[model samples]
Target: MKYLLDTNVCVDYLSGRYPAVTRRLQAAAPDDLRVSSVAVAELRYGAEKSVHKQRNHERLDVFLREVACVDFDRDAASAYGRIRAALEAKGAVVGPYDLQIAGHAVSLGLVLVTGNVREFRRAKRLKVENWRRG
Candidate 1:
């Protein structure tokens, strides 16, 4: 199954904080792994603000080389609109970037690999898996 990795999962994989997440990523086919453009933006923002900016940027570059980056296009926009409205109606809205990532994954029918299951589970029909759970 194709997987869209959330920013927190990427961070865990990159920093080696979660060995199980890293092992799962290593075991999966590189072609099956994807990152939303919104997640990439979040990664870049984190890297830009880090004390080890150059190192973090290099790490992100290497990670991006192995995983595909999917843009948040028109389809994702439509999904975002529906998801946002639904979550709002339920008073369970997630953060903007998280919403965008969820929308992108849902639009492409890809499973979302995240650490924030409770937050992501708020989006209707979003397939979420917590890689941190191993």
Candidate 2:
């Protein structure tokens, strides 16, 4: 099984801040772990904003080495369109990046691992697991 980790989950795992996500990583196959380009961008965005930019960049480098990055391409755009419409029609609000992450997961047929489950669950047909909630 494969999981497209949300930005928050990616940061949590890379920083070794969450025991649950860390344990989940130890149990899962390294190859089965994946992340989207949007997530990479999100991580970099966070790193740039933090006081310890150099340290964060080092951590991101290590994280990037271990996890494979999947691009946000045409198929993800199509998935975003569908998910956006679905959420709009239902009056559900999600952050733009979260929507993009969800789109990437749906497009790739991978379960989305996120800490913000409430917003992600609003995205119809997108499977979400909260690795941070354990």
Least accurate stretch of 10 residues (summed lDDT) in model 1? 89-98
List TM-scores for all candidates, in order. 0.98, 0.95
Best by TM-score: 1
lDDT of 2 by residue, 1-134 (tens): 89988999887888789999989977898899998999999899999999999999999998888889999999998999889888988888778888988999999999999989888888877999998766
After superposing candidate 2, which stretches have Cα over 4 Å from the reference? none
Q: Alpha-carbon error at 85 in model 1, in Å?
A: 0.5
The TM-score between candidate 2 and the true structure equals 0.95
lDDT of 1: 0.94
